[model samples]
Target: MREILTLQIGGYANFVGSHFWNFQDEILGLREAGFEDPMIPTHGLNMDVLYRQGETRERQATYTPRLLSIDLRGSSGAVNPSGSLYERPPPAVVSSIHTWQGPAATFKAERHERNKFLQSLDDEEAQYREQPGDAKAEEIVDVEVNERQRYIYQSLEEEVQFSTDYLKAHLHPSSTYQIPGCWQGVTPFEDYGTGQGLFSSSARSEEIRDRVRLFVEECDTIQGFQCFVDDSGGFSAVAADLLEDVGEEYGRTPIFLFTVRPPRKVYDTLASKKKKITHALHDSVSLARLSSIAHLTVPLGLSQVAACSVAEHLAILDEKDYHTSALYAAAINCITLPFRMEAVGPSDGSQSSGLGGTDMGTALPLVSCSDSRRVAMMQASFPSPALLESKGEIFYNLHNTSSLTPSTERPKLGDRVAKLLVLQGTQLPGTTGERATVGQVHKSVVKAHEITAKTGRFSSRLATSSHLAISECPLAVPLPFPFIFGNKIGRFGNILSRTVGGGKQGRGGLDVSSVPVGASVSSSEAVLPYIKRRALDLQRFALSRSTTGPSLLQDWGFDGEESKDLRERLTNMVAAYSEMVESSSSDTD
Candidate 1:
């Protein structure tokens, strides 16, 4: 098995990562529930790719994600930092202290209480421990225990204020790290320079490196690392340093970075304007630095998700990180599905020439365009309707969810772009909703590509180099998944011609279980505009002395020299895309 190490930096990134892991936990649960079918085959996916098997001190088996998650102190909420596999000792009493007895005054802080969902999980575990090993008894206990938990999970919109509130997976003790002296609301970790030199401390750096080495040494064959970094703040700097260390130690391993941000809010105050400018500068600098370290960088999140075409059928709350993160997590889950798929036979119509499913090592290069384009955009269509439901339409409409925007002007003739498409659990529309075969899925994608090119949804003159992958397994909606889908979505994720009246309503009055997803990672000129915009933002702030840009950057610890270097890097990135387009134009001539 080729194992992949996952890393998540910052609170928002962890919010997205929590949802992503919940999806995986749901898949594992479904497989255990004997929910496999021809339409949704779980056996074809190898869970070992992202998970590790181990035994607890009590000789009981435990399966946990091979992940390293970092966040500010007190960000973990009710979840224990040591994890659930081991028992936690109770808080020590002040009376038990023997030292410092003179003039001692004790003040206890209130601890975060677990929500109903977590409490239910504890109750279920206790019930299981008390019961005998009879299969029927265990089944009965599970059903009874899950009843309340399911209700709470589905109704968690108001309760899930933090990532840990809805988290379903049990992380290993060593997988979580909280930065000392950094509290979410109290500390100012809002810029790239705030996180600089955080890992420079020898003790902290060595501890993180040792933990990473422990996970790496256990894997038989390590494929690469998949990282999620919060680019809106200091986490970006933290991730850059971490990735740099990983690169130095394991130079051959590939790194795929997803720089994520939450929905941006608008304000018109004078102070707010200055803050916005600071944020823009931070974003540009973070992107330039982080993208240079990772093999492939995909920027995610939108200023307003509800304004996007992808959310047309869905009801989204722009202010809620729970809703926005779920949307991004679904796309990430679908795109990364191929990384863990079991290799079987040759690649039918898939892009890669290799046999079966593609790995990160092979898949990264396909979209990166041979390293000439390291930055790419991602688009997704969630709850993609079945063929029959859409009047025999084979392909679902895709919308760009990444920050990159397509140019208003038509692309020049002979402009070539590359995209890696992953379609999951596409059904043939009808009451039966039978899963489409590999050939059917591939044909539909090709037809969609041709139609898209003609319609100029991407660009009329642009020639797209498309690589397709199809999976029979759809994304399972875990209990804790946010109810962002509309009432028009059916229980199994099919699109109803009309919205359902009412039944057992969850959040947003929808009850969706599994969803077919269409997601793609593309390397094209579409990213040119985004790169250029950031580059201009950096240059405008760095060179203009009239504005507070230089002073603000200096406050964040970026000297004049570092600011100049960042601008140069952004310039080079923009030039890379510009050169690719010119080279393609010349080849056509």
Candidate 2:
């Protein structure tokens, strides 16, 4: 079990910083399922930003550290962070060892003692950085970035001198030590303090400290480090040589190569569009003449849409020739995403009912119709009179196959029309066990029975008087029929001589709803009932802009005080939602 758990933790750590992983998609799906913000994607990244959001701030109103675990291990073992054995669990004892060690024994106590002993050894080693035989106080000056190279030289000299003396005393042949003594080149060894914290103390001293620190002691594995600068300023000859020597000792490569880049300044050229100032960098210490590096590619404007297939095609096409032969050739093979366009209603921004805006210089018309009569107005291809009176007995057939293509070939004209008809609002139905669609494509299928009867009754009601009293909330909006419908019935006239798909001529201000077949009908019925179930789904959605309080507050421009207020409000809302759900479920029960 431990091995399996360890593997799982390792796998998680391996991808800890990987960006290409699809964490977003997985989290979005969770959001759609109604998970609260705290349990979802918001917890994944950019945690600090989220804390500023309004509601998030409120949720953390209470804080308590829950004593979440009890350690069962009772064994003595060395805790070596660098050893491979660190990954394994320590051996366990059959009985409690704390009884013998006493109540004072604890992991913290053991760790503290170990650390104190290590500190003593470190303090003793610090003496090496100063004078020998006579201890004198020395100032631990902060390293400056500008003096980094010089500092590296001084630190390396101390380390090399100490190492040479030690080697001569221990492993070196007698001759090397005798020659140094005879040549009067032997130097007393001095101890340099630990290089830790020197790199960040000050920019100048840090550079010098870091450059020579590696030579203080040899390490089995050498990790290379880098720093970026606006200009080549602190590199030195001794520093460079010491680095190369250290690298050779560790079988690593080392060199200080400087590259000069173009300075930032304003300049202009006779180009149609503006461009940023840029230039390639070249190595300074090259033995031969240097060649130019590859030019950087910078994407701009429409070219950036290459990441999306549909955007790429649209960006390339011109509006004037968008539907011409050339466009067909270009777009035919273009990868398409499922496009969905909805006529958002003004009230809820949902496609729920009658259109918004005026029907000319007149007040909005409220018309009434019987359910049966209204059903007749909604037809598939055409309406059958017998079935109209028969109620919605006959099912109307409408194909939404335009967007669909055959497995072996491209979409045809019929498929395109089918897609358009479905988008325009048509109804289709099927049973649970059916292999194909339930409705048939009859030449003159009747719409639902109730709508047909309603339209007829409405006409009869209008014929009775010139001034008809419209209801407060009528079943339908009485759009003025744009074209003249003479007493001649069953004849359909063009409401707009030209509209969008009505050819090149533009459409006049007319009630478009009256002209199109089943235009007043809801567009949702065309899809299967299961697809429409999305409306009833009780999924939690973000009312607040962000999942976290800090981020939500920051994004909505809420100040600290305002954020605190909003957070409290959100907490109340969450409580309300929970109560509502519980009440609803209780009622159902």
Candidate 3:
């Protein structure tokens, strides 16, 4: 078994990770419930790849994700830090106060109460424990449990108070670590340097390192690390430091990093302008540093997701982390699906090794283009158009769900590109809603390739390679998922002819069980603009002497020498993309 250790870095990263884990938990639940789908007979998924099984001190079996999450104090909301699987020992009694020799003041705060959904989960667990051997009793207790959970999920507010509110997976006791002396609203952890010196203390750094080493020690064959970081804030620095330590300890282990951010609202004010400048500088430095340590880095999140083409058919709130994180979680889940697949046979020279088997080591190079371009962009089509319409026509449109490109213009010819496309749960065209077999899916992909070739979708001066991976199993939407779908979506994530309204309007009333999704991670000239924009912002603000750049740099602990180094690093990154484009164009001419 090749194990991949997962890490979630900040509040928003945890928000995205929470949804990702919930999807995994839902799949596990379905398997345990004996749920079968004829359309997807062979899932080919090995859950052990991402999970670990062990026994607690009391000899109770426990199954949990091999994950490590770091966040600010009080960010976990009502979830216990040690989780609920293991029993907690009672606090030691203090019989005497010999140090102070005086009355000590005591202040107690109100405890957090569980939400309705969590309460229901507790009740179900209690009932299950009461009758562990009684199947009839279990059935009776769970008769209307799903319906109740769905209703509660639907009634949730648009804003997510905390990531733990929707988390479904049970984490190990050491999986979560909250930074001391840091609170979300009270502490100002908003810049690239705010997290500096946080782990300088030997005790803190050693503790975190020990937690990671514990998980790594258990793996027989370690594949790599999968990291999700919130790059919009100080967590970028935190993640970079952690990864550097890990890289030093574990030589040459590939780290696939997904840097994410929630949508931010733009304001027209002097303060906002200064803030934006600082943020731009932070972003440039964060990307440069993070990408250096990571084998492959994928930038995620849009400034305004509601304005993106992917949200055209759906209703989403731009300010809600709950809504935005769900979209990111879906894409992340689908893109990483190839990592857990079972190896069917020998390699077939495909990018993903013929869909029979693939790992982070094999998959990272495909999108990174042999390390010449380590940074890539992600685009996905959630609820992809793979089903037959009511008029018997099949639409294979894959929309741009990512913020990598704001426009829909075609790329210039002679631009080199490498793309990896992952399509899941697609049905064959002309079928009566029957899921496509593996062979049929391959045929559909071939047709897609032919169409793209005719339309010049991937025309380039140099060679361009596109790899396709197909999976019959669709992404299952758990009850805790945010209500982001529109009224036109059907139960199975297909589009309907008319809008149906029976539940609350604009509240995602449609009962979407699962969705066919298409996602691609690519390294090409198209992502040049994204890189150049940040580089330009950094140059205009940080490298200029006429502005407040120098003072801001000093405030972030970047001395003159350090600032120069960062600028050079970012400039080189942008130059690499430009050189690729120029080289391709020159060859074509």
Candidate 4:
């Protein structure tokens, strides 16, 4: 099995060949931090690392055309006679479903289950209406727990709905054919030209903003949280309290903020007229009308679910309840779900979901506080970069593998080139412009191969660097594991710092050539001799003195004729060193 890491880039035009191409910058950063290439097996390790285990076969290499090259003018992919193109062709859909079925469906089912649990609590609350407050203490606490959980779920569902609706509204024109002059209020584009325009809301908009602040303030009180941490780790609980007091006095309860904007096609369809004939007495009226309107559309099922939940909340809530702190919280939660969206127009494709359209309805379950223990166990077992770098235990032997082992096979040309390019980070200049400079390459080669009187020594020096550099390419991808489990990592906070820190001692540093010329030698012309002397010095002392362990030269999985060539070159250098030492000794005697 083979694994292929596909690079994804945001823009192909600007970053086609640069390090930033396909997010290489981020991937490289991850590599430097100790991540390893992902391994893929068809039958196993296909699931999340939290669940999967055992050795996995890697997948074949895969690459895609740049994202920027996608044709947006009509549809996507091959065009039919009617000029229709389908984006996200069927193979992608099948792949997505096959890979994510468990994770996606589980999340949806979980939300439904949570809703049922909340409903049960509501029923229990109704039965205790006649009891005395102090006498039913146990029941009251139980009911409160249930109510709180239900509130959280309800809030989440509403937030998901609102989010979907907001997106839908943003995609469609605010005014329809029935209302020609109608506008989607509070256009985000009002502040387009003037950056400051976005911050300066109109009076009515400010009123809405104030209401939102009040709702958030009330939410804090409802949640029983007295303080919240700012980015700097400072606490601010009193600020909301003060704001609430003023809002209460004014009877201005905050409502959650909502906005909508016009669709792009509306302006594009507007007619433009340039009159060429100059009329002596012209008072002509010209009118531009939209010939046809293209309806904005998104999937229907998601919006339907969101709409149903929203309708239920709207029915239950009083006018004042609409402005309640809980309402805002609930709205926010409902709209944020992956499936939620506003219904703009009818769906473009068929309504039958599973039969024709690939099922893309589900999401991963939200990790609950109660499941923390199980999650912790899962996390502990995963192979995070920190664990690999910690050098806690050598799980796989990088250096002692058998000669015929799969791991020791000769690398492909691309792999060798990748290694050398990666190594150039340390040995040559880091920047492309610097390394690509003709003068620098000439100087580096002349200095590195000074002892050799041969004219074509630059190519030999480059080859030597490539041979030594091929050992570190595997670290370019992330390991398929987690560093820690449960509350151990504390929600993305770094917990394996020590492991990563300790392992950094064996990490690579900048590759610099040492020259052997005289101490007083100076000048660009003297560089070749100096570099040659330094190369000889390294040959003699690099094993004990260089930062990287000398054994690492064999760890990078070099094989085939390439490895033989490198070994022969090193052997010749050693012999030359011995002869030079003997000659110098004889002269001294």
Candidate 5:
């Protein structure tokens, strides 16, 4: 019964945020064939996001309370968000109602005495001056004054509420997809750049306040909090602020952060150098600052796929790497499984058997709460066929074994320390349930807890003649996927493949692979060096540019020197990535 609030900030984040919710919704069986008692994820809240971009029209048109509750009872025939009455049934229909409380005899005696006293007023001049009926009277009337004040206050409150609701209704968080009993932050359409206006907007602030007052405080057995921050400045800022406030008051309530690194879009030829450099710098500074706020932060990058068993082995011509998000989105569902589906439950004959997993309330401390503040990133691995199609299927079977080796097993091989979220295998995907063996759990736990090695130590440099390096494995990720709305697909292949064993990569981007048949497996080879290098270049450009670059950094509470420091640290990794891409490219002479 432990509760954790899920906060989604920024446009892309909302997409991923929705996937996270969808996963929970599927797991708990809160949809069509409802579970006996479906529950929110043990990892965090269902989700509250400031969504922009691709929002459903229904969500776009509504202004729901940032905080809300759902009635699975179907009592709420329509979408009525009426105050507290939403929970309890309206006062039962009654036979008769009496309004008067006083007896007729007592009322008449008091009235008679009052009339006599008023008639016998000894000081006519004093009484006349005090009389409110007199136009010239100067006396103050407390009752009238209170009444007017109350009217004005009520009107103002109503007006303010209306305006806020109007704006909130348009936000992605306020949309129809939101879960019952879940609270959301106000998603305002008015985005003032990335940092403040989006995260600390008036609406955003009010929503946070409401979330704390309503959800956080109300939960009697609340555990920790988990936040998903997009690369946007405001989203992370607000998330940090809210977590800090709650942490100060709640004392030691662990807050885990899942932040999406700004994808590298500069590789596109049409992209201007100025824009590329600007984005890179902006992202680096934002990530660096965000890293410090969360107790433990997991940063995700699109470049992660460069280290995969298949993709890295082959060459990808599409520089856009648009599928990176899709891949990450799928990875997110798998990696977070340890926390979300703590214990597997029994299937009640649901079509997918997705509800076989149970909550790991007792194991909360194992995954959700991280004491180490250092190492704010982890490497991400996604199996073949992108996420939108695979649903939650775990690809790259041979990558992990029945003996789940820790992502950090080879600690001494590299100098740059890193962690990997190697969520391998296909089990409990949305609508598709692959029985999870206790042996698998044992392997996953054994490796998940093990602290691994650093980045490449002796790996050859990319372009530079330098010897320093980082293994793609060591690059830090949030330990969660980069799921988004449309990007997080649940392609379970054909119903035939789903029913049988692993086979082919389907047109729907579904994986046909059933159980691991051979020695081959799926694995994530982190191309972190490329990711860090890209960020470094962006940061360097930001620092090298005019005062505007530095000012932008300052505006977001990041200083110039720190940005420079980060770039410096990423020097080796960047070089290694450059070499890998160069050597890996088929066109290379």
Candidate 6:
């Protein structure tokens, strides 16, 4: 069984990656038929832990990855690039403060005070009153010796030894924490950059390259790779490029990218225009390059998933949308359902899925492919029904295995059929045989897609229906599996009475096309809105003399020509889908 290697670049990506691993099929172990012998035993690569503190010198070499270069035990891979990087500590300058600093100084001071007290006691020779200030010095010293010597020894309470932990606390405590996880149980761990990120400058540096070489060599059994690039376009783009190079050198490995961006609206409303422009340029440039390298790249951003405009309480939510990483993590667990599931078959038995005919040496090739037509597919995913304020048929429409959502003007599903995998969460309420069973979820799936001439937007919203072949990818893909915790219950407020579509008075299923997992539009179709917006923005920026005509793209290592090429291909690709739909209808007529 070919295993897919996963890599997380930058901060948010690492956060998502951590949760993804913590919530998968192998949280216990992998047990598929052909996948019996896992391909990527080492699992994956993580870049955020690069310059970790003492990880190298202190900790035992047990796990390949631990978190944050903040690690009390992360490797010291930082290089002294310039002045005073480590010129030397300037010979321990002993100054005024050093004399009275610390326990030793306190001890010396105490001893000195004690000695002065003793001297005072001794100096109290017979302080001869009156004029006797002249009693010979030898006689005074003789009297003092005789007086104090007569008073003998002193005693006090017995001393008690303190606890070992206390001694350790004051002395030295263990600095390294035993973090969980390993690359297939243990080997050479890599550090990719400074604590902030692997900046563009460091992407191709010798240190990072060496680490990549080592990572690939060890992943001899890997068949495919999944990468996470969250918001850090410069560094992540470079890293993604390096992986692409590696894939080309050894095998034409299919690389899937999950590029997460925060809500653009959030930025537009909250950030400076220059910052927004900077983000836009970085995002567009990175998307262009990363798209070229990966077989498929999915965009994840807050606003992309349109919350319903229905009653105030009717919005689609996944438990909590507080953290982007958590939401993306939940989505990852949902999207990767096919690999984790028992081989497709009758619900009665535990037979192995016999589709050994591997594509590109990988098992589930359709989910991720090297097809140029399939690249840049729009992605959407609904973690569970709990995300909805109201449950029932409308709740069913918000989930998709392909993560496809409707485009602004229409749903993005293309002429190709879609494959849906419905992963059930434990929160799914049902009695004994009724709760979240395959049959239950299957019914929910069918109910969500049921078409009635009089039903909610099913008639007019079918914009490109005739030419587009909805079932040919073959048909919509859905998978219903055992319950998962990521789909929590009671997180979204108690059920409310509401309409499926937007208006408060309306009562019907959601304009299913508009919900989060609303529809199965082709990724190409789904990306049009964002792409068109980007193209227009870039054109102005790339054309303006003050902006240096495409220098931003150049700075980020994205070629101006390549940007135009990809954008053009996508524009044409979406158009072709429309043309195909139109032609099919004409032939039928």
Q: Which has the greatest TM-score?
A: 3
Per-residue CA lDDT of model 6 for 321-350, tens digit only, reads 223343465555444433323233344211
| Backbone clash numbers for all candidates listed | 0, 46, 1, 39, 57, 28
TM for candidate 2 is 0.15
Full-model lDDT for every candidate: 0.77, 0.19, 0.75, 0.20, 0.35, 0.36
Query: Over the stretch 495-548, how does candidate 5's per-residue lDDT look in tens digits?
Result: 222232222311211222111111111111233432465465555565664535
List model 1 lDDT by residue over 1-589, tens digit each.
8999999999999999999999899889878877564445666788899999888889889999999999988888888877889666486454664776479443333678998878877886897799458888778887775565556766687788778888889988889998977776777887877898898778888989998998999999999999988887888888988999999999879999998888763222555767768877887888778888888999886767877777766777888898888888988998898888777675463432112377888888878875547888887777666653245566644432333222212234455667777888777755344667766676675666567678753354454465667787788888777777877777677777777745534333225667888787877776788788889999988788887899988877789898898898888888888886777766656
lDDT of 4 by residue, 68-149 (tens): 1110111111212111111222421324335443543211111212233234434654765656467568676987765564
lDDT for predicted candidate 5 compared with the true structure: 0.35
Q: In model 6, which regions exceed 4 Å deviation?
A: 24-26, 29-206, 213-220, 264-266, 269-277, 304-322, 342-372, 375-383, 386-420, 426-434, 443-488, 491-524, 557-589
Model 4 ranges with Cα > 4 A deviation: 1-160, 163-202, 205-589
lDDT of 3: 0.75
Q: Write the per-residue lDDT of candidate 3 for residues 351-449, one digit (tens) a residue.
A: 231263578888888778754478887888866765333254333443333443332223454567677778777755432334555555565555544
Task: Give the better candidate number (2 or 3) by TM-score.
Answer: 3
What is residue 113's positional error in candidate 5, in angstroms? 69
How well is each residue in 496-577 modelled by candidate 2, as lDDT tens digits?
1222323222211121211112211111112212111211111111123322423322433345664344334333323432
Better of 1 and 3 by lDDT: 1
Instruction: Indicate the worst ten consecutive residues by lDDT in candidate 2.
Output: 1-10
Error of 3 at 348 (Å): 9.5
Off by over 4 Å in 2: 1-557
Clashing pairs in 3: 414-461
By summed lDDT, the worst window of 10 consecutive residues in model 3 runs over: 400-409
